[model samples]
Target: MAPTRAVAATQMIEVDRLDRLLGAIYDGPTESPPWNTALQQMREALSAAHVTLMLRPPSSESHGVMINTGQVTSQGVESYETHFFALDPFVRLPEGEVVTAEELIGSQQWLKSAMYQEYLKPLDIRHLLGADIYTKEGIECRLRITRSDDAEAFSAEDKALVKLLLPHLKRSIRLHAKLDYLECDRQLFAGAVNRMLVGMVTFAQDGSILELNQEAQRILAEKDGIVRSGTGIALSSNHENRDLQRMIRQALTGGPVEEPVEGPSVVEAMSVTRPSGRAKLGIVVRTIPLGEFTGAKQRPAAAVFLRDPESSGTQPSQEVVRRLFGLTRMEAALALLLAEGLTLDEAAEKLNVRRNTARTHLRSIFCKTGVTRQTMLVRMLLNSVISLG
Candidate 1:
C-alpha cells in the first residue's frame, strides 16, 4: 500500500485537476448562448455517463437543465422535472454524498420504483451516480450520472474522481443559477417596459427600436400620438410644434433633453417660434449608446421618450387602472384614485391638478358611479382582493 503521505499527495493532485478543468468564470453568462458549445464542453470535461443541470427555487418544484437540451426543445428540460422527479428518491440525500452507481442500483428504493424498472430497464440504464449541492438561494440541486447495464456500476475510483470534481460542478451550478435568475429579471423588466401606460419607444443611439411599449404602439397606431422612426419624430400635425421637435433633436445629440408645458407656470413660454397651439406636445428624451442595458453595445440604436395625453403627468392611466381594478379600462380609470385611497388633494398631486379641479372630476366620478363617498367606493371596488395594487 502507498504511504499515507503519498495517498494525500495523489488526492491533492486529483483535486487540482478538477479545479483546473472548471477554470475561471468568464464575465456573466450571456442571456443568449449557442447551445451546442456549452453541452460539448461540459460532456467532454466531466467524462460522465450522464449529466444534468438543475435549478429549483425555494418552495417550487426543481428542474434539470442541460444547455443543449434547453435549446432543441425549450420546454423539454422542464417536463421530466414537473412530471417525474418529484418522486425521485435519490434527491433526498444530503449535500456532497456521492452515491455510487451500484449503490443506487442496489437500493430498495430503486427496485421498488415501477417507473425505474419498467422505464429505465429498456433504455439499458442500470446504474446511477449523483451529487447534490446547494445555492445561496437555498435550492437543493443534484446531478444524476448514469451508466449502462453492460458497464459495471461505477467503481470506487469513479466516486473518488467525482469527489475530486464536485467543487467545479458546484461553482458552475452556482453560476448557472445566477444566470437563470438574471434572465428571469430581464424578462420581467422587458414585460414592464412593454406594458407601461406611456407611449414609450426606446432605441439605440443608431436609431433602431429596442422596445415600443404596448401603450406607445397603440398611440402610434391611433394617430393620437406621434413617434419618429430612424429619422425623427414629428413636431405636430397642425402648426408643427417646432420647440418639441427641437427637444427631441437635442436628446438625439447625446445630451439631456426635456420639454415641459406649464399647465400653469410662473414663467411665460420661450421658444424660437412663439406659436400658440393648445394641448402642446411635450417630449422628454435621452440618448442611449448601443448596449446600454444589454451587454453588447450594438443591440440598441436610441431611446425616444414620450409622454402622451392620458399620461399627461396624470394619475395612473386606464391600462394601469384596469390591471389594478380588474375592471374595464374606462370605468377603472374613472374610479382609480378614489378606489386606491387617495383623497382629492393626493389625487390632484398625482394628476398635476389643483384640489378644486380634482374635486370637480370627483363630482363627475360620483355622478357616473352613484357613489357619494370615497370610502364607500374603495370598499365596493376592493371586496375580494384589496392588494391588487
Candidate 2:
C-alpha cells in the first residue's frame, strides 16, 4: 500500500476503537468508581503501564482523589499524594493538549526533577503523557499515562488520540460530578425526613411502590396499620384502603386540575386507623408532576407520607436544644423533660436536682424561649428543627 493508503488504513482501525472508547466515556457517569472502564480502555489502546485520573488535585487540606488502572501500588499512591504531589513540576499543562514529560521539559531535565527522581523513577515510570481538563463548572483534573523506561516514547499519534478523547472525558467527568452532588442531596433530605420519624413511600403510576425509606419499611414490617401487599401498600381497614386507593389514583392522574399547584389543598390528607388500637397514622397523598420528575423507567407519580401520631417524636439532642434555645445544659435538659410530659417536680426528681433549682432553670428556659407558659415551651421545642439535625 502507498503511504497515504497505509495512513488511511491505520485511521480506519483507530476509528473502530474510538467508538468503544466513546461508549466507555459516556457510560462513565453511571459506573461505580466512575471512568475506570474508560481509563482501562485508554491504557490498552495506548499500550501504557498505568493510567491515572486526578479527579481533584491534592491540596494542603486534602489528599484529593485519584483513580488508576494497571499496575499501581498503594504505597506509591500514598507517597505521591502525601509527599511528592507538591513537588510535581509537569502539572497544569496547556488545557486539553497532550504532552509528554520529555516534551514539556528536556529528557535530561525531566530525569533530574525531584518528582521524577524521587517518585516516578522508583515506580518504573519513565515516559509520561499528561493532559489537563477544565469544565464549565470549574472542575480541574488531570489525565496521566505512563510507560516503562525501556518503552518507546509517546508518538504523535498517541498525542492526537488523547487530544481527541479530551472533550468527551471532560463532559463525562462534569456529568459524574453533577450526579454525585444530586445523590448527596437526596441522602441529606432522606436522612432529615427519617430523623423526623416520618415514613415516605414513592409510588408509580400503576400504584406500585417505587421506593420507601427506613421508617416506612419499619412501619410496614410491623403491619400495625399499614403493610406491603405485593408490590403495592395496604391499610388494615377496608374502608380506609378504599379512600387511600382513591387518593392514589387521583394523585397519579394529576387530580382534576391538569396544572400543578402549591399548598396544603393540592394534596389529600387523612387519618388511618390501626387494628391494634394504637393512634391513627397521618397519611398525606400528593401528586408528583410528570414534567418535574425526569429519568428512570418507572417514575414516581405520587408521594405517600405516613406520620404516626402515637409514636414518640424524635428525641432532640440536649446540645442541639441548648444551642437552639441559647439555654445552659441544665435548662436544656429540663426543657426536654418538660417536652416529654414530665411535671417540674418529677423532672427535678429524675434529674436529682432540688425543686428550687428546677424552677430556676424553667424560668431561665421560659425567658430564653420567649414563652411564659410550660405548654407553649413544650410545643415550641417539639416543633423546632433541632431533631432534623
Candidate 3:
C-alpha cells in the first residue's frame, strides 16, 4: 500500500540524513570519514541505540578494524572477539543483502540459541539489522544497527533506508582501499630512494632543486667543493659550474633527443676538486624527459648524480649479491671487492686469501654473473640498481 503523507514526510527526512552521511564519508582528506560521528548519526536515524562498522567479519583467527557506538563496552567487544563471533548468525547470511535477525531466523528460534542466551541477553540486545557493504577477494565489510529488548523490531522503512545507503558505502570502501594501496607504494618508493648510496638530486626546469635523496644531503653538507647556493647547487670551480649550468639549460630547453650523440651530449661527466686537495668528486648530469603533458606546476628536467671516489659509495650489499648471482659467501665478497675498484692481488691481500684462491673465486663469480671479464663484471655491478643501496 502507498504511504500516508506523514509517513512519506518522515521518510524524506531520513533520506536527507543519508545524503549528509554520504557527504561526510567522501568529503574529508582521511581515507574514510570519522566513523564515530557518522555511526552515531546512523544510530539516531535508524532509531537504534547502537551501530557498528566492521571492515571484516570477526573470527577466532583474525581481528579486523571495527568502529562502534558507546553502547558496546570494551569487555563486550572482547568477549565477542574471543567466543561469540563464531556464534553470530548474521555472518553466515548471503553477501550484499540487508537483513535483520527476525528475517534471518525467527524471533523465537534466536531467543533459544546460545548466541542469545549467553551473549546478546547480557547486553540487552534484542534486535539487529545488518548489511555487507563490501564482499570480494576474501574480504568482507559490514554495517550493523542494534536495538535493546524494550524497543520494537526494525520496521520495513528502516530496512529500505539501510539498503538505499549500501551502494554509497560500498563506493567509499573501494576508494579507501585504493588510497591505502597507493600510500603503501609511496612509502616503499621513498624508502628505496632514501637508502641509495649514490647522491641523487633532481632539478626543475628553472634549475631549482626539486628533491634530493639522503646521500645527496650528506654530500652537500660536507661543503668541500659542491654546496647549496640559494635554490640551486653550485660547484667551487667556476669553469665546472658554468658547464653544469649550461648542460642543465640545454637539457631543459632541448627536449628529448631522438638520436644518440657522439660522446657527451646525452650525459655530461666532470670532476670537481676538493679544497683539501684530496680525491676529486665525480659528477654526472643526465636529462629527465617529461613524458606527457600533465599540467603539473613543477616537473623534473634533469638529474644530478654525485660519486665520491674516496667515500666508498654505491657498494652492493654482499647478501644481495649472493642472492642475485647465486654465488657463495667467498665468491660474492671477491666480486664486491672487484666492483669497488680492487685488483685481484689487492682483493686477495685484503681477504687474506692466496692469489690462486682469489682467481678461482673470480672465475666462479664470472660464471654465476655470466660475464667473461673483470671489466664487464664491474660495469654490470655498477649499472645494477642494487648498487644504489
- Tell me, what's the RMSD of every candidate? 10.1, 3.5, 5.9
Candidate 1 lDDT tens digits, 109-208: 6866864665556556677777778767776666556666776666565566556556666776567667789989977776654444445666545444
Lowest summed lDDT window (length 10), candidate 1: 265-274
What's model 2's lDDT at 152? 95
**Candidate 2: misplaced stretches above 4 Å?**
1-14, 256-266, 292-296
Best by TM-score: 2
lDDT of 1 at 377: 73
Q: Between the candidate structures 1 and 3, which one is better when assessed by TM-score?
A: 3
**Rank list by TM-score:** 2, 3, 1
Per-residue alpha-carbon lDDT of candidate 2 for residues 233-329, written as tens digits (9 for 90 to 100):
8888899998888888778777743344563233899998888888888999999887754766488889999988766756779999989889999
Estimated TM-score for each candidate: 0.54, 0.90, 0.68
lDDT of each: 0.53, 0.87, 0.78
